[model samples]
Target: MINRDLIEVFSDIAREKNVERSELATILEELFLYVIEKEYGDSSNCSCIVNLDKGEIEIYSEKTIVKEVDDYKVEITLEEAIGKEPDAEGDLDVGDVFVEVIDPRIFGRRLVTTAKQFFAQRLRDIERNYIYEDYINRVGEIVIGAVHQIQGGNVFINIDKTELRMPRNEQILAERYRRGDTIRAVIKSVEFTSKGPDIVISRSDNHFLYKLFEMEVPEIEDGIIDITAIARHPGSRAKIIVKSNDRRIDPVGACVGMRGSRIQAIVRELNNEKIDIINSSEQAEILVSRALSPAKPVQLFIDDDKNYCIALFEDENLDAAIGKNGMNVNLASKVTE
Candidate 1:
């Protein structure tokens, strides 16, 4: 009855933690071994079995039958061995191995408390491993979650019962998060930590903008249009260079969608960040010229050896070419580079 009750309690916790039944059984076996080790100072001669089907746990201790018991944990007197199994009175002799069954009740309440602690910790470790394995393969994928906490400029989002962290540096500067607010971000990294997997999400990452474009534009997802390069100022502005495999389809137009619907959706998701989609070109001068959009350069001097381009713009267009804080020129450089 005690064994059944114990298994029931553990199984309930295991279900809540999403731990596999087989894993729970393995943990139960180890937990009992830990308890035995604490009680006897050693568990090398002990073995534990957990039967989930029957909700039973069986513990067995191997002891050597001797003329007299020296170490009670590993050795037992012949008389005691015979007393445990009367049917093997003649078969059991000195120097023979005697197997003794341990009663769960013998562990008492104190040991049960210890086992609970061990079991809880094992479940936590299993949960941590599960979270790590799940998110590691999902890096760079977009996840929409509710903001669960905001502390020290970091946002904690909850998605499918898992909490993901978005550090201040990874979040858009213009975005404000409150508890229960819906948020979307890309899984930037998954790192193992002592507490659990450190799943860092990002909204300001270049890949986040790429993923947003991919989601908004079916052409990008279907490989009809490929985004070759991307540069972002996060909540301010972003630029992407795209190429169309099928000449009939214009990459920039496809990304923009009909009446600017697709690009508008993405822009709204990103808190109205400006996005410039430039069609990729094979010619260096053409590509650089397209990258510096909204400001046409009068002449561009290319230094192929240094991988540099010096653009000469009209005096009035210089400010637009450079953009606020040189954001335009910096993004153009990134795209061309």
Candidate 2:
């Protein structure tokens, strides 16, 4: 009855945590062995088998029959051995192997409590591993989650029963997140920590913008358009260079969508941050000029050896080219590079 109740409780928790049945069995076996070792001082001769389907756990201890027991963990006296199995009295002799079935109840209430704690911790570890493995493969992909916690300018988002962290640096400065607010970001990185997996998500990353474009534009996802480079000041402005594999499709127009619907959606998601999509070019001058949109340079002189360009812009366009805090020219340089 104890075994049934224990198995039922643990099975429910494991299933809730999405732990595999096989993994739960392994954890159960390990838990029993741990308890056995703690009680007997040694579990080397002990084996635990778990049948989750039957809700049964069997523990066995292998010991050698001896005339006198010195180490009770591995040796049992013949008198004691026969006492356990009277039918085999004639066959049982000194040095013969005795198999003893252990009742888990014998471990007492104290040990059972300890076992529960151990099982809970094991489930937590398994949950951490599952979160790590799932998110590690999803780096650079966008995830939408609800804000669950806020501490020290860090946001904790809950999605699919897992919590993701967005640190202050990864969050958009202009955005304000509140509890229960739905937020979207890209999986920036996954790191293993002693407490658990530290799943760091980001909204300020350049890849966030790239992924937004990918989500909004089917041509980009379909391989019709390739985003060549991205430079972002996050919450402010971003520039992306795109190349069209199919000559018939206009990469910029496809990304813009009909009546600016696609780009508008992305802009709204990003808190109205401006985005400039430039067509990629093999020629450095053409690419740089396109990168500096809304402020065309009068002339551009490229120095291939120095890997630099000198742009001559009209006085009226100089302020626009440089942008607020020189962000425009810096992004242009980054995208062109």
Candidate 3:
């Protein structure tokens, strides 16, 4: 009688833990073999037979045929071998190996339970490793998830394989998350904790803008144009510096799309935040001038030693240069940095 109940229990565990059934069976097999070795002494020539249909287990021990038995667990004399095998003397030699059947019940209930616990712990380790590897490579990439819970002012989201906490500091002030609402965030980092690997996700991160723009514009995805730098005020405004590898392609126009269609999509995703797509330049003055867009800079004073530059603009365009609450200049400084 195969223990259908035992198999079913394992099936339930596999489903709950997101593990493969075959992998669970392999872990159990290795656990049993280890238990058998601990109970019996030497297992260099040991084998386990699992009969799931019969709900039976059999362990066999192999002992070497030797002229003199130095270790009783691994070796047997010719006379002893012959006693176990009637015609062993005619077909066996002193250096040969033979199998002996051993009772599986000898391991006892306590040992079997201990082995099961060991198997469970190993399963947890495998699960942790799988999660770590899954999220580590996704750092700085965007993922779509649904809000699962709100606790202590922190939002928890459910993504593909695990839950991520959007720290209160990493969230946008204008954004509100409710249960079942789908949201997009960038994976800022992955940290290993005592419990498991913890993934830190963010909606305010600069990479969030890069990822959204890439999704909205095909030129960026095709490598014709690429984001060289990004700065975000999150929920308010952002600036992205782009460069085209091919001279024929206009980086700014490509990102802005035809009549602002592509940029509108990105704006909708970002809650209507203002975005300034600037062309990247290798020269410091041109880069600073481009970083302060909409309001053209009249002059740029670069101080390489102090690592700062002063941007001069007319009084009429001062508000455009500084933006609301100095947001534009702040984002420009971040972009230049």
Candidate 4:
């Protein structure tokens, strides 16, 4: 209480850490209890009361009043109980526990050292839970973050309240980030560790493309179109299949929009990456035909037993069908398989 700066210091920590002022109170209480344990040998019945307004912390050790003391830590003679509390002489029974106020300052240097240890660990634990609670339900969501730092060839991004890791593997090959640059990614996983939640985000994930379309296209948002499958090359090109519940609606047309306005927004978000929109079909051959786009296969033979298909097209369509590096066929095979 003598150091009024304690209140200001706590205020600054709460503000900077993005946690409630009350959370610091909880930490202070635990720190005081830790000090108590160091000074008193046992603190099972010990409790700490922290008044953050005055920057004051008090420790109380409670023990049951008994006729005879078997364990001095847990049991106190009625005389000793009455000595601590004057009214205990008549009002309290042998089994009734008495609260004894212990001076937290008595621990002195040990208190300061122990308090630091407890505060560091407790703060980390609380922060981990805090991070986990913040992003648990946000998994599979696309969030915007600023590049915080690049460590060991991996990117760490600063989101709304905290930072998250975006490993090299999750990054788009063509995408680059500088400090403070804004980037968007899908929340792939949130792992809670002893220190904090290890949030893994990705821009290369196929789900990122799916979410971008859902955000840009009203038909997809309204449930008129369902994106069934996506095959992506991350910052290069991707093929997607969509289907409509309504017979009158053309899923591909609806997704592309008039003048290509709708799909263009998604492309821009992906840094002008190419996207192929195809209609989904129930028939395997029809689906495979649509999957292999910009190339018209003249004839196709399906062998369900072998789980393979023979797709024959005019020799002129060979280069286009296989794509520049067989990416078209590769993506088609992924969709069909």
Candidate 5:
């Protein structure tokens, strides 16, 4: 007879976040029957029911009751069926001939052990899927993780209780992180594959700076200031364009903080990367000149299509206009557009 206490398995899963024991139970039963059929065993006629209350489980061999019982292979005589169930009639349901608690020992010690192994494997698969979906939904946001281990070409990070591969290509060139270090990065993607979901992270993304500005500047966070664009060289320098929704608020001053402390904290994490916050305006001439700040441009000229800008500076100021490795011009172009 099927035990009613098996409902407890579903109850525990309901309390937990992701475990669905009802679905797992169905898979376990299917796997057990498949293995039994392959071994050409009599277990093909057996069924199982879980008893959660007593923490016990049982298996039984089932047979249909027949009038004459001509075919013993698929049917049992009414006389034998009635003895198994006193209330059984000729038209009794198939439940009447089911043997109660068939000694699991009859299947041999090895057969009983196989069922346990199949159940464990299915449970592990369900847990992995639970963790995978949790991470996938938080894509494009910054998250902190622990460095689990350094594989040959990639570092494995433990985030949301799952190991994710951080390859060398995704890591910043000058940044070197060791095991046990807590690091943060933006989630680039959550790709689902045959094995599982793969979460990709990036430390050098331009969006990282935009997010940092949102955190450091109260004006931006509260919607008084808006970040139009940002460009980063990662561990070296970055440029951000900002505008204020309110007439009185100064977007640049708010982000810089008193004595340059706010932006400085972000600079330290990026290995002293310099940040230049510029004003964003609709006027091409005004915006272009402001974009190239820290380098005064006396004469700023734009092309016919206004795609590129040319600046004329004194001989002494030309070097300042284009900083080391042309970083100043590169950042200016990115922010201006």
Candidate 6:
């Protein structure tokens, strides 16, 4: 039977995809039998088994032997049944039987054509979901993959089995990734497109900064530290507010790591983007002050109706606090909020 070759094909596919051998065998067998049942109409009396170790498959048709053939479809004559299997009876258990009645020309040329089309369509559906599941689970998590190609300034990354696209708007202005270069980014979203699933990755996403901290600082992963807020200017500068859930734990010191090694790695990944890790406070004034780190603020007054906080700073701290083109103020607003 072609079933033997089918097992081999499944094995190769499993190896390429790095899936478990048993899982691949089960999927192939289930799909193959489903195709056969769809073709034959009734699978209640038919059984299909796949032997992964031997790379073989077999199909069996179960029937009962009777003295006189009453129904040609479901019953076989006693004389013919005995010739194939002696001691077969109508009431006794004669077990399952198979005959090489399946025409290869029909199975290969007709049924298999239909089967291949069905399998291909089903596989595309599965792969689409596979891509969606992989990316959806990574929302707010950072990933590193190679930049394989580009289309209209949209970078395409080869992430595992799927290709992810980071559009120009989602990319950091100060960062550029050439073909074959590795890029670390955040999984902004996973959306469904007409063709399939679309993995929307981003370098400018604030989630990227959060994920970097999560990866760099072991305390965050262990839940000993918590990130209260994150605001970023992509390649320029970013601010993160963290607090220690456990009083004994030093959130900033732990995130900075010994000799500033952890934060340095994160900075290198961000193309030398400056990151300010500060302690978080429930008080809006204190939080806003910390959000606008590196600059000394004289006063912070929150406007209730406008939802804006007017901050007064010394002239020297004004430029440093507002940043070029008010980038720092914008980030501070986001993190403080």
The clash count of every prediction, one per candidate, is: 0, 0, 1, 0, 0, 0
Between the candidate structures 2 and 6, which one is better when assessed by TM-score?
2
Q: How does model 4 score by TM-score?
A: 0.83
lDDT of each: 0.93, 0.91, 0.83, 0.84, 0.73, 0.77
Answer with 3 or 5, whichever has the higher lDDT: 3
**Taking the tens digit of each residue's C-alpha lDDT, what string does model 2 give over 159-201?**
9878899999998899989999999999999998998988999
lDDT string, candidate 6, 121-218, tens digits: 65676678777877788777778899999899899999775888899989988987799999888889888887888888888888777888889898
Q: How far is candidate 3 from the true structure (C-alpha RMSD, Å)?
A: 4.8
TM-scores, all candidates, are 0.95, 0.92, 0.74, 0.83, 0.77, 0.69
lDDT, model 4: 0.84
For model 4, how big is the CA root-mean-square deviation?
Answer: 3.6
Each prediction's RMSD over C-alphas, in Å, is 1.6, 2.1, 4.8, 3.6, 4.9, 5.5
Clashing pairs in 5: none
Off by over 4 Å in 4: 1-25, 49-58, 63-99, 109-117
What lDDT tens digits, residue by residue, belong to model 1 across residues 201-290? 999999999998999998889999999999999989999999999999999999998999999999999999999999999999999999
Off by over 4 Å in 1: none
Order of quality (TM-score): 1, 2, 4, 5, 3, 6
Worst lDDT 10-window in candidate 5: 1-10
lDDT of model 2 at residue 140? 91
- Native-vs-model 6 lDDT? 0.77
**lDDT of candidate 3 at residue 71, scale 0 to 100:** 83
- lDDT over C-alpha atoms for residue 335 of model 3: 89
Better of 1 and 5 by lDDT: 1
Name the top lDDT candidate: 1
Q: Give the per-residue lDDT digits (tens) of candidate 5, residues 70-106.
A: 6554477667766766864555654346453454445
Query: Candidate 3: which pairs clash?
Result: 2-53
lDDT of 1: 0.93
- C-alpha displacement of 61 in model 2, angstroms? 1.4
